[model samples]
Target chain A: MQALTNRVKVLDQKPLTFKERLYLPAIFSGMLITFSHLFKKKATINYPEQKRPFSPVFRGLHILNRDEEGRERCTACGLCAVSCPAEAITMESAERQKGEEGLYREEKYAAKYEINMLRCIFCGLCEEACPKDAIYLTETFAPANYSRKSFIYGKPDLLIPDPTKEPEAFAKAQGGIKAHKEKVR
Target chain B: MTNHLNLLPYLSIDFALLFEKLLLIIVVVTGSLVVAMYTTYAERRIAGFLQDRRGPNRAGPFGILQPLADGLKLFMKEDIIPTSSSKWLFIMGPGLAMLTAVMTGAVIPWGSALKIGEKVVSLQIADINIGILFIFGVVSMGVYGIMIGGWASNNKFSLLAAIRGASQIISYELAMGLSLIALLMLTGSLSMKTIVEQQMQGGWGGFLGWNIIYQPLGFLLFLICAFAECNRTPFDLPEAENELNFGYHQEYSSMKLGFYLFAEYINMFISSTVMATLFFGGYDIPFVNEANLANHWGPNIVALLGTVCLLIKSFLFLFVFIWVRWTIPRFRYDQLMDLGWKKMIPLALANMVITGAIVLWLNK
Candidate 1:
């Protein structure tokens, strides 16, 4: 006998008029609406040829960062491996040998770093947990690969280009995320 | 029979004429197949555009090669036949559909006769006097494809859909026939060539010539019935995908299934051409004197242009068919029946009576 939220409405069950029964006018109007849509901008981005820009904080694939001096920043601390919800990261630490200072930023460095991209959730937690700013989630996502072994990204796959040796690639790898942040600020 | 056979040799066989007609048949069949192929592509593209999305564009430039790829895929698929099904009838169903679909094109006058060297070749395959009746007969037979296919499948959904398709076609045929009666009265002939020629007769200036101007209600009824006959959206209850689980061809696989699907597109193409021929002046170029053009550029060129014009008209109709498909939702089966039997039949009957009276008054 009492309505709950005053949202209930009576159904319009009245019989249709002669004009409504004809259906042509309504059909024509609906057709006109659809026809107009032919000129409207399409929502799809033609995935291969064009791509939508990711947000500044958009976390995608992991990239092992290199400092401006082209030295690896990771000190083999294993914080990223601990913070990774997916447990996708693994590494083997080796004490920096003599004459290896140019290669590594710290006394202790990762000898073998791998990220199973199939397991990585792109949550950016690993990036947040890294103390030395060794790892970051790049704007680029993981690409498709045929083999499961190919998805197990090794140091060669995850490492950013040496800035001093390949400045163009290094800048390109860092360009989107940094520029997006700057623009937002 | 022997005497007739002997006279046939004296008739000289008209080998050149026979060859030309045979060539024309091949051209017409292949051309229709190509159009139907492109129509599937267009339907997807138009549907995409209407929904504000990009459709298939990966195969080739703007996906022009998509249909070829689709045909290849269909060809490569594994053919399966249910063990319970009637072997011959199940096989014959899609074949029969393909036959009936292509047969309708035989009587449609594609263009004026072309003059070649020492012979005049008509673009039409067969300018049968009872062209409209022939179309009706073939279209009616099209139902057997669905009926036999559905029944042979031994599936309840398929059987139900087949019954629905048969009833829908049968009900709509009444209204369709009644509406065409008025047009036939106006044209004074059932021959498509004669109707088109009549439409083209009274100069190039007035809109009064096209049957749509005179039998507006009849044209509307015919158009609606045509949509019903084509089993397109708004009347696609027989293949209500969600409800009927793929309908009459549920058991079909591989190219057999492709044939059933291809038959629908062929039906749409033929219906569009028929509508153009009956109501819109088939190959008559509007606002241009074709005779003058023929005199200036030769009959062959003019005939080609007329063919192009007819194609353009049919394409516009096809576009509208696709447009309407994407715009409207399917009708309830009961509503479909009600519309076909009660509303359309009465309206078409009334239109026929009024047109007959007017024709009589004009004659008096």
Candidate 2:
């Protein structure tokens, strides 16, 4: 048969030589190779003590964004809930009261928001659908927990720390994603 | 000359002799067990290094406490007994394996005799006339453990693996025995102590008397057979995890399984010591006149140093064992049998015949 491609080559089907049949020299050479590997640097990272750097575009847990003044960025427009492929997001909208201007960034605010972590595919579709930069995917993943019910994350769980009250925590939480965004810009 | 000096004490048994023997036995058994434990750790570490990875560096520094942690885990595990299995025979298997492995150490000479004041203390637990034969008897018995365990399990895989192990050991034993016969002819005595003493005397630079120089072919044959007998990789078809799934110990659980694994390491340790004693000059410190050293630094000190030398030699053998395990892949069943019967047997026979002719010619 003709060759399908130039890369195809015929294999040598010759019998083993006397030295090859002996096996000791081959075994010795193989042992030498493995012995040489003893000095080679190991590939292990000693995990828990050290961790590898995640990629710049790595998306993990959901974080509800807030403005610099610490007021909620979400207007309860339900765009993120509609866009979520996993159907994990849910919210209840409420009309902001007269005295609640400090808490709400818009007249309409989310009274309750929940994301079922088990159901969330972490595809970052919800982050893309948000018009007000209200939601973002942080570089920190969800931790292991016992009960199934605990996986249903409430607004308190997803919300970023208020910048005015906990500036260090908010900055630390936003550090990786913000740096990555600045690099892209 | 040295054998005569050592033999006189065996004629009569006193309280001191009995006490000395008991102490020696305790020390040897405990020492072998501890060495076997560390061997598991070394095997893993060496295997990891060969693969360009770190293995078991937790629990303690460099995983020094890994064996202890493993032992504790095995003990803590549930002891499961298969309902269909023979309870009595199933229990006896690992115990028999461990017993035979430890029993072979009785004849190996740890060091030259230590002289403390007017009394002389022999380092060996037993100086039997048929020392090599006793070792052979014990090593052959080791297969029974595998056989019984496999048979008792009533599992098809276990039984098949057992048969493979038994046949492999039996086939290799022939080559091993034939190889040793050539060395026995040269040494002219079956006693382990006598063999070492012979090697220590009348050779160039004090180290040329080792059996490896005279019968390199015999040593090679014996070493290959030892790997087979120990059921290490390349010959570990019986415990072929991919094919047999724990093999003979498939039904075994907890400490019983631990016993089987521990027995293998002990077997490796004992075989290494045997190889060192048989070919590498057991307790005979290379390139040094031990008698002259004893005069300068006391007999006890020299004896201790000699023991240390034997240990060093055995450890080197153990390292080679681990190294080979990592380097070679397991042989196919047919290939294994072909190597044993067609290759090893014929080579060993040729080696023995050549050795015999040389001995006869030299004597004439």
Candidate 3:
């Protein structure tokens, strides 16, 4: 008990010496130090207008991709669901109807798809697990929301409207994204 | 009542009298505040220049409007009161700080007598007979502001700092008071203006004249004591950040904190003015007394010019205060105490004794 109490740093310690107690010389030294820091380069950045470079491996928002002809390649194989470590992804599979040919790559397609972002740890396991050239994690750093319910994403919230999108979705998709997609195919 | 004397038919309101008093107070208060604000800017800029950095040009061209912006910011900030704090006392803390600050400058002879249009005005607020003692009296009370603020804060860090400060200041005040005793003895008057007069009329040349040459030891003791009194570097334990973060005003926020900070600069300025007045001969142009200048243009002009010269000297002394602050390292708490009591007190005593003996021998 005594040893533990002794280990604690007491606020009231000891008396200063006659000279040390006066404290003028020491104060001057401290001022000199703070004054020195005035001239040193400041470590401030003007953010937002200009952004910093992100690493290649930076995990961000998830996206489902379309091929060159604007056709989704997901087969509703359930491979991504099995590989998702966080159990964040959920899906229901339905067989492609007679007229819905080539709309999905496989005979079966994901009829309902959802990802609970709260549970999705951004580990990219689902991205890696899909054999077909479909799911991907993009390089957007921010996926902020006001509430927990807002975090969970559905197909409409996460998906691109047009498969043959003229504008880029992912910032990296302009160059390496297409190349990486071809390699995956 | 009686078949009485007739009342004056044209008795009038003394608006001019009221106006003069109001104008003087306004001028003095405004001047002190302006000086105090710029003193902070000057301290930062000088320190920056010494360390090779541009200081505070961001606020307004060379930070000319920095103090004004600072004042506006402080005024706009929320006035916070700690839940546990004694509300009245906490509010009183900064009030006392500001009061003591401006009060000390009241006796500073800023400029000489001058006629604007027809009315004569002297730069100082009061020419009190107890000028030096008045300074000491007011300065001794400055610690109370810190003490009250710390106590009202209800914080351990502030309390510790307050205790350190009260004891440290009280200890040094003795040496400071003692050092001045010799100066008072040599001049034989408490009036600051009269002391300057004595320094002038002495048969010895003005070169040999000033109190600095006469009581050199007194000047050393007084200077050191002034440093301790003002809580300058080597003596600034009250606000030592390492041991007690933010010192006595740790709990203070916004303009309350600004009050404490601005008051420190004011004290430094006041002390510098006092030192110049006492030792260097307040506003006395060397070898050319106001009487000589009066030969050229009335006594008022000479006195006015003399006042200007004195102000220049005092302003230069203020720069010296900043210079010393940047150069010296703070002494350890123990070292500070030792320097004050063990060193300054004994030297002050010996200086007094030696000065007295010399005076007696010279008279013989």
Highest lDDT against the true fold, candidate? 2
User: What is the C-alpha lDDT profile of model 3 across B1-364, one tens digit per residue?
Assistant: 3334344445665878668767877877787688889988888777766666666666777888888888889888887899999999999988998899889877777656667778887766777899888998898899888899999999999998888888888888899888889888888888777787776664433435678878877887788788787788768888899989989999998899999998888888788888888898777777665565677898677777777777677778778778777777677899889888898999889888887887789889
Ranked by DockQ from best down, the candidates are 2, 1, 3
A106-138: candidate 3 lDDT, tens digit per residue: 678888888888888889888888898578876
DockQ of 3: 0.08
C-alpha lDDT of all candidate models, in order: 0.90, 0.92, 0.78
Q: Model 1 — interface RMS deviation?
A: 0.5
**Residue-by-residue lDDT tens digits, candidate 1, B214-245:** 88899899999999998998999889999999
| Number of residue pairs clashing in candidate 1, backbone atoms closer than 3 angstroms, sequence gap of 3 or more or interchain | 0
The i-RMS of every model, in angstroms, reads 0.5, 0.6, 5.7
The TM-scores of chain A alone, one per candidate, are: 0.88, 0.88, 0.73
Best by DockQ: 2
Candidate 3 segments exceeding 4 Å error: A1-185, B1-21, B116-120, B200-208, B286-289, B294-304
Write down the lDDT that model 2 would get.
0.92
Q: TM-score of every model?
A: 0.91, 0.94, 0.65
> How far off is residue B248 in model 2, in Å?
0.3
DockQ measured for candidate 1: 0.80
